[model samples]
Structures are given as structure tokens and as C-alpha cells.
Target: SIASPWPLLGPGQSTQLIFGPSMDAAKLEEARMLLNGMDYSSQDEDGDTILHIYTAKGLRECAFAAAEKLRDLGRLDAKEHKGKTALLVAVTANQPEIVQDLLSLGADINACDVKGQTALHLAAHYGFPGVLQAILSGRPNVNLEARNFEGMTPLHCAAISHSVTTKALSATGLTDVHLQAKANEKLSCVQMLLNAGASLLSQEIKSNKTLLHLAVKEGNIDLVRYLLRIPLPNVKDFVNMKAHGHTALHMAAGLHGNPYQEEILQLLLSRGADPSIRNLENDQPAHLLQSGHQGEQVRLAARCTPPRGLSCVGKTQCIIYPATRIPAK
Candidate 1:
């Protein structure tokens, strides 16, 4: 019997196959044979083609097969209603093998969807170092500094990941790459981006906060120490750098109850974080410390000298300035 060239999947059938429970190889092969000669360019009301549906559902082999077929038919980069390409969808779904196939089939690695995020951006956010490296290798022109709507680079996404798997580094033959167990997975991602020359000082679009600021706010003491030892050309300037009137020091001290905030604060201070630097509200980092630990306060005081007229206050807070209009009436 001759199989019909067109799959002609109804909306319900397509939804079931795309988003329903996993189908075995026999079912998948049946669907693939039916759609073997069908035009995959047709879009549903949502503007998602068969390829988009497969990628979104994270059907690995199905997505790869659909992507290659679509590529041969000149519809590889078809956008869903939201402007996300199959590559972007695959990355978001964390389908690394599908991502590999898409890249090999010549999907646009640098294509930013509606959110202005490229495949690399999504890979970084999802902590898929393997996917990131795959995209990077397939497209030598891939921009490491690509920014999304939030003005966040791949490096920023990596730094903010809950965890990053470094297994890819070893599998990809990156033995010399430093992977610190103390800092865990997210730290590995950050390290990979750093090794790739991602700028650590790049600020977030909205908050103007640097990657170091985010790491400190996360209360990752190991990440904080790693960032401090990055060895910049102008190390002192980098340490004293402020973003939106806040420094890493301020972020560490203001983290209401983070157990590591105090240790992070000391690390920042030892690296020359100026306690006198105030935010837009003119609150010094010392003022942000919730605890009145005399030992900690004395440690901070020793690192920072008061401004010309300002004097260090008790352990509660420092940087005392006269409230009166004149020194003497």
C-alpha cells in the first residue's frame, strides 16, 4: 500500500503528538513516514510550523528530523507567531541534540527572536554549556556579547543560572578549563564565559548592575571570591566601580539575612570596596549592615578612612556627619 505523502495532522492530533505524553519510536516513525514528503512550511493559527511544534515539545529525534526536512525545503528559520525560530525554541526547551542538529543544518545561531535573545542567550540562561559550545562552534560569528531585551549578555545569564553542568567541558576536550567544585555548577558556567572573554563589568540594561553585583547578591561566597580575583587591567578601579549608585559591597551588606553576606562584605572590603561610597539615597554600605557586630564594624573601619569631616560612629553604623548648618553657632 502507498503511504499518503501528507501527514495532514489535525490540530488535535498535532497537539497530542507535540505536547502529549511521549510516543515510542514506532509511533514517531509512523508520523515521520506520513510527513516525509509533506510541506512543513504551513503554519497553524499560532504561526508554529511542524518544526516549531516539535522543537517546543522537546521531541529530540522528531525535532532533528523535522528541522533537517524543513532546512531542505528552505523553511528552516521559520518563525513562530512570537518570532522564535526553531533553534531558539530548541534552546529554550533544553534539547541540546536538537540544537546540534539545527546548527548543523544551518539554522541561524545569532537570530534574536521577539525577546532579542539569540540561541546562545537561551543556552546560557538554561545552564547548557554543551549547547552553548555547540552553537559557538557551528557559528564562528556567534556574538558572545549578544544582549536580550534586558540588555543582559550570555555572561550575565550564565552568572545568574542556578547551576551549570561542566561535564560538557570535559566531553568537549577542555581539560585545562578550571571547574571549581566549591562554587558548583553556576560557577562553572561563569568560568566558561570568562574563559571565552566575556566582559564581567557589563551592566544590566535596567539596573546598571554588573555581573559581580549579581554574584554578590546571590550570596555565593566562592563566586564572589572568584570574581574578585579576575585580575583586571585596572583592578583597583574595577573594585571601586559603582553602578546605579550601588557597589558590590552595598549589595552584600544589604542582603537582609544572608549568612554569607558578612563574609562577602569582608572580601569586598579587603579588595578595596569604599565604605564611604553611598547610593542614590546617600546610604553607605556600613549603614546597610543589619548587625552591630563590633568586630565586623572595626574590620570595616580599618579598611576605610572617613571623609575629611566625617568620623566613624559606633558599631551600629559609621560615617558620622554634623547635622547642624554650622560647625559652631
Candidate 2:
């Protein structure tokens, strides 16, 4: 149903636009004429309309033409099945020129989809700063906390993508009237926000995760160091503290093939992370080491090697070679 009324649409006010096996232009034209005669602004099943269909299908010409028609009908702001206006779809598709065209036709930039996300939110969520810039320049409600299914705001979205390091992303941060978030790991943009006094420990909406967990999961030692320098979060902090009551060290072990295990271990130990911290099985980091080469490495790390002066060749700390060098008496 996501791609519906393809190549044709039928008249008679039916919300059912998805007819399988392709449609005919003559049929679509007849339907369009009916809708035009009825002064109907748009049609959709549930809420998807021609604009959504065109944007999703990348039918650029059709979409552009439909947008113009919507403008003519003064339905440029008309929402489809889920309160998703045409403009939101264009931004999500990364068609900036289309977005500009829609905006020029007075498509509502502040129009919210079913999830209460605006064009600006969608643009940011998709990491299209050009689209986001177009939306923000209009100076819509920056304080509007438009949420999605996850109840996350646009600032929350900004925390997870590359835009964190981009000037385009930074530009939008200036206009967030709510000053809602202070950090996000995915986008890495939260540092700038925090640097501007965006609050290093602002609360997350759904999860208990903090910047510590985010850094640990991402394995960004620099971020970990930065966070450690700030507050030194504990199990009580916002990040995940359950499962093993683990800290960043525990998380590092779970990280795949931790090449810098030694370095990370040293840092954590220096920072007061307890090496004897046990898991649910009551196993410490030492106990987690298995036998063989890995065991040897772990033993070496823990300074558990045999005494150097007396060697039983890894079996014993002291070895006497059967008195081979003993007296000839």
C-alpha cells in the first residue's frame, strides 16, 4: 500500500488507492478530473496521497506538477492519512529542490505528521541540513517538541548522525528555543550543545542511558575521557546500570575484538574502575579469561606469570633439573 494508485487513480471518493498490477493514465486522468470538478483538494487511503506516492516513488515531475496543482487548489498544506502533509515527504526523500518548490507554493513547514514531526524535524532526522535550513529560515516554532513514535524530539535525532560535526547542524541548534537536549552520541553534535551550556547530564526521554553508556557502546575513548573528566557517572547515573552492574570496563569486554583492551583496561583501572567487579555469575574480569593463549595473555596482564628466577617451564615457579649440574662426588 506504500506505492498505490500507480499510473492511474479511480474516482468516487474511495480511500483505496492501491490497485495492484499497474494503472492506466486515461483512468488516472478521469479520476483527476472528477476530483477537480468536486473541488476536492486530495485523496488518500488512511492518509497517503499523490504527493506521498510521487515523493516515495521518486516521480519528480509528477510530484512537482501535483505540488503546483495543490498550490492552485489552495491545498498545499493539506495533510494525507496521518496528518503528514506533502512537504514532510519531500524533505524525507532528500529532494531539496522539491522541498523549495513546495515551500514556495506555501506548503506548511510546520505541518506535523501523525507522529507530530514537522518538515524541519524530518529534514534533521534524515540529516539533510539543506532541507533543515530551508525549514528553519522560515522561523517556525523552534520550541515545538514534535515527537515521533519514540517520543524523541528533533534534537534527540541530531545526537546520532554526522551533522554533529557540521556547521549546518550547528545552525539549527541555535534556534531550538526549548534548549531541550545537551548531548547525543549518534550525531556527536551534543558536545557543541553542551559546550554552549546545553547541560551535560540532561535526562533522556525513554531509556536510562547516559552519555557514559553512549560513549562505552560507541567505544569513543576520547568521549569517555571527556565524560569522566566532567562528572564521573556511576550506576546511579542515567546510563544503563543493570545486567552486571557494569561500568565502561565491562562494556569494553562486550565490545567485539577490543584491540585496545590493554590501554582501555589501564585507563579504567587508573580511573578507579574495580577490576574485581563481578558479573551475574560472580565472575571477575580475571575469571572470564579462558585457558590457552588467551589465558596466558590474561595471566600476563594480571602479573600472574611464573617467578622468573625459578622456572618449571610455565608449569611451576621453580624447577630443579634433576640435579644435572649437581656435585660429581
Candidate 3:
């Protein structure tokens, strides 16, 4: 019959049914029933039970049914080939209901996959604030500082995610702290991790870049501002820290045409960033400005405020120049 894909299967052997999302409710039931009638512990090569596949595919009904069967069978924590649990799959699939169900069934909330990423990392990276909150509320001991293979905590992932929402910013009463954060900004994940005790001092295992460096490189102006405002232990190290022989200001200076780059440069400067700092190429932040198209803007900004006394002479008068248009490229 179609159900018997594995002939000559031993009693200890595991197998799986290949089902599709297009399968109707009736066909799905039939597939589940057929599998239930056979080995109760059947799994695919990746060690995924039918439950893992259903959760991964966002098949809530199928996943629920499989979870019900597996929970009673004491297989709720079964690991796939990569050590991923059904709970992890549900988080990755954005299936919040399934995630809650698995958690209610006593699934290990802090379970790490092969890459050492927990559900928190996935939720943060995907910007699922609700799911992240659910996980945190359910498991208070869940390590907020768990580093994935890339040496990134949930905080790092939140910084890198473009979809991250700032619901936590309001919930944690941090709205007033991040004044520079735009209205309805998608940086609440950073606030969430910080409130949950994620470390700001943590660096990527490979790049040695701090959260500030990543934020600047990604052009996340709000995040850069938020990090700059953090008190205690001094964020000055992050502002001036060198990565690959370049400071965060050095990276910001090169992003000339970015509309926010000017504001970011100003923020960095106001936070005590030294423009004189040079990179490996012996390039100062001002020297890294792009030429041709952005040269005029950079030059004007560089000239706007001269050294405290260089151009003032004995007079306190500051010269104001008329705005001139730079010829288009």
C-alpha cells in the first residue's frame, strides 16, 4: 500500500511519512492514523517525528495531534537530526499557538539546537515579541546570555533584525530612555534583551565587534543612539573600540549618502567620538567620506564648525556662508 514506504523495516528502525501542505484535512488525518497504527516512535533521518515536520510547516492541527500523541508517549522532547525540538521548530515557523502548546506540555524552553541557538534567538531574530515574551514568562531561568555558534545572544540577533518591534520598549518603561528612537520603531527587541539581562559587553566570537559596532555598520541610528545612552560601565569603550582597525565612527563616516549618516555622525561626535581616530589605512573619519557625489556635503559639514580658535582669531564672530548647490553627477 502507499503507507508502506519502508519495507523490511526492523522493529527498532525509524521512518517518516512525507506529507505536503496541500494535503486536505481528511488525507492528513488518514496519514496520521496510518502512522499511529505502526511504530509509535517512527522518525525521519533528521530524527524529526511527524510532530517536528508539522510544527515546522505551521500545520497547527497536525502538529497538535502529533504533540498530543507524543506527549503521552514521553517523546515530547525528541530531537531531530540537528538537535532541534518541536518547540524550536514552532518558534522558527512563527507558530505561537504551537509554541504555547509545546511549552504547556513541559517542553524544554531553553533547549539548544545544533547551532546552540534557543527559541529566544529565533524569536528575537524574527521579531516575534509576543512569542519571546511568552517564552520568557514561562521560563524565568532561561539564559538570556546564551551565545549561539556565531557568539550572538538574543540581543545581537535583535539588533540585526529589521523586523524587530519595540513593544517591550513600552512594557519596560524604557520609552523615555531611547529618546532618539523613532515612533513605532522596530528596535524593541534590543530593549527586551537588555531588560532580560543580555550583556552589552559581549562581542562576536569572530569579529570582536561590540553591539555598537554592529548597530553602526547596519546603519541602525536609533539603536546607536540607544546604546550610547546606556549608563554605567561606560559605553565610551564601545564608541571608541576598534574593530579590524576601524572605529564605529570610521564606518559611519564612510556611509556618506545615507540620509541618517549625518545625524549618526553628529550623535557619535556629541558622545565624545574623536574624529582624529584613524583606521588601518590611516584614514580619519573625515577622510573616509565618499568622493564625487558626497564630497560637497562632507566638506561643508567638516567646515561648518571650525576648530575652537582656528578661524575666530580675536573676534567671536562666526562666518555664515550662503547655501550653494553641488553639481549633480
What is the lDDT of every predicted structure here? 0.67, 0.51, 0.68
Residue 89 displacement (Å), model 2: 0.5
211-277 per-residue lDDT for model 3 (tens digits): 8888888666667778887785665665788887888888887776665676677677667676667
Per-residue CA lDDT of candidate 2, range 25-79, in tens?
Answer: 6654655564455433547565666767776665555666676677787777777
TM-score of each: 0.70, 0.45, 0.67
Candidate 1 regions off by >4 Å?
1-34, 57-62, 163-183, 291-329
* Model 3 poorest ten-residue lDDT run: 314-323
RMSD of 3: 14.0
Deviation in Å, model 2, residue 132 alpha carbon: 3.2
- Model 1 RMSD in Å is 13.2
> How many residue pairs clash in each candidate at the backbone level?
2, 8, 2
* Residue 265 alpha-carbon offset, candidate 2, angstroms: 7.2
As for TM-score, the candidate ahead, 1 or 2, is 1
What lDDT score is found at residue 185 in candidate 1? 44
Query: Which model is ahead, 1 or 3, in terms of lDDT?
Result: 3
Off by over 4 Å in 3: 1-39, 57-74, 163-186, 229-233, 302-329
Q: After superposition, how far is residue 151 of candidate 1 from its true place, in Å?
A: 2.0
lDDT of 1 by residue, 255-305 (tens): 766556656766776676766778889887767766556535534543333
Kindly indicate the candidate among 1 and 2 with the higher lDDT: 1
